[model samples]
Target chain A: MARVVVDVMLKPEILDPQGQAVQRALPRLGFEGISDVRQGKRFELEVDGPVDDAALARIHELAETFLANTVIEDFTVKVEEVAEAAK
Target chain B: MARVVVDVMLKPEILDPQGQAVQRALPRLGFEGISDVRQGKRFELEVDGPVDDAALARIHELAETFLANTVIEDFTVKVEEVAEAAK
Candidate 1:
């Protein structure tokens, strides 16, 4: 199995109302030292496969298609193999 | 000045209750294709500094002291210098 981390955030030009709302709510959450909130989404996915360039490409496609909005958001993909094959 | 990105995540041995709650909420939020949720946090900070080794180290300290729970969380800090002085 392989573990993948994906993060999706608003484009710089987009107005992030949801993030703004989260910011507004933080004062009551006992969090200080933050002047603003730029909220985003994160996903950790576990896939069963031998990780290779092929796995990277397929997951990236899935990320672009379903996990991210190309127009208003950008995403990064991080992958780690959970188990190493015996060498 | 410089920019920093800090990511805080649950320790490998800990149970992520908040992450689990968020995962349960996602399907109700109309997000499909996800069977589990492992949530984490990301922070972007802009600090006024020349961004030398010292700046990097101080930010790492802040990350350890206030931004993360040392016993239950692990953090990584990334710094980007915003400008440079004439040399």
Candidate 2:
């Protein structure tokens, strides 16, 4: 099966409260020297057949419509092959 | 500045309710031929300086302690250089 990976991230201008919270907590946890922690979402779709252009376009549409909030977030879709299990 | 990417996903054996919801909704929205949808989280950390081995290990600790639930989810960390703005 082919895996369609979608990465949804907040726009640079958007304020991310969760990220900020993580940043604040990191220092308390002793993970210093870090800044600008932005959190986002990822979706991995296992497609049944070949991953062609048409499939990709549809996935893009899905990303725009359901996966990401275009007004404040940006997303990208990528296709990958699922590896076979070893004996 | 450097960009550190942390991708957190549910384990293969674990059940993903959110992903299944998306898969079910897709057909209703007329996007067919998709199966086994898995959803996850992505964290983008902008480090103030270089992303060396020491920095990476700390990030890994953060992922384990705060970002991912090691029992049910898995996460990976990747570092990239921040792009320079065009003049």
Candidate 3:
């Protein structure tokens, strides 16, 4: 099977309270020199067959509709390179 | 400032209900050809200065302690190569 990865992140304009919380917690945890902490989502998919262009297109559509809330977030899709499975 | 990205994923043996839910919902939504679906987290950290080896080591420590719950999850950290910011 082929593996596809989808990365979903909040829009740049959106206020990420979770990220801010992490940033604040970092200093308290003694990890300094860090500023912005943006949190995002990643989805890994194992497709049933070869990861051809058609498979990639379908995954992209899936990402647009199900994986991401496009109104507030943006997403990118990538396919991992895999070796052929042993017989 | 330098940017560090942390990719956190659940251990392969762990059951990922959310990912399973997404997988089950896909075919109903007419997105076929997908099988295994695993969901994870991504963290983008913007550091206050140049991304030297020291900064990377610190980020790695932060990732091991706070960015990820090492018990159930595995995380990888990478530093982004950014052009020097405008003066």
Candidate 4:
């Protein structure tokens, strides 16, 4: 099997309250020097076969269409690994 | 500044309902061949200085204590980038 990873993050212009909350909490927790924190989503898909360019294209489409909201978020898709079974 | 990325994922034995939901929806959405899906969190920390070993150790502590629930989740921290200003 091949593992594909998709990371979806909010656009820089968008307000990320979740990230802000974490950033604010950091100081109280004694973790300092972190100026910003942005929280995002990561998806790992186990594909049944080798991950070729075509597979990557399809995964990119899936990331753009189903995984992320283009209006406010951006996503990146990459092949993480190929299991021994696939090799 | 440097960008540190912390990826928090559920333990292999833990149930991931959100990932299961996405996996189920994929076939319905005309995407197939994905046998399984796992969802996780990615945090981007923009630090005010260089990301050295000491910085990484501190980030690891933060990730363990504040970002992930140690009982059910695992986390990995890596330096994504160091901005030119920090160089």
**The candidate that achieves the highest TM-score relative to the unseen native structure:** 4
* Quality class of the docking in candidate 2, CAPRI style: high
Could you give the C-alpha RMSD of every candidate to the true structure, in order shown? 6.0, 2.9, 1.4, 1.3
| lDDT scores of the candidates, listed in order | 0.67, 0.88, 0.89, 0.94
**CAPRI class of candidate 4:** high
lDDT of 4 by residue, B1-87 (tens): 989999999999999999999999999998999999999999999998878899999999999999999899999998998879636
Model 3 Cα lDDT, one tens digit per residue, B1-87: 877899999999989998999999999999888879999999989888888888888899999999899999999988875657772
As for candidate 1, its clashing pairs are none
Q: Which candidate gets the maximum DockQ versus the true structure?
A: 4
**TM-score for each candidate, following the candidate numbering:** 0.60, 0.91, 0.94, 0.96
DockQ of each: 0.17, 0.86, 0.88, 0.94
| Cα lDDT of model 2 by residue, B3-86, tens digit | 989999999999999999999999999988997799999999988766778878888988999999999999989875665554
Ten-residue segment with the worst summed lDDT in candidate 1 chain A?
Answer: A30-39
- Candidate 4, residues A2-87, lDDT tens digits: the string is 89999999999999999999999999999999999999999999998778888888888999999999999989888888878636
Q: Write the per-residue lDDT of candidate 1 for residues A1-87, one digit (tens) a residue.
A: 667787777886888775566555545554434344455666676555565787777668766876678988888898744666552
Model 3 C-alpha lDDT versus the unseen true structure? 0.89
**What ranking of all candidate models by lDDT puts the best one first?**
4, 3, 2, 1
What tens-digit string does per-residue lDDT give for candidate 2 at A18-48? 9999999888888888867999999999887
- Cα distance off (Å), candidate 2, residue B12: 1.2
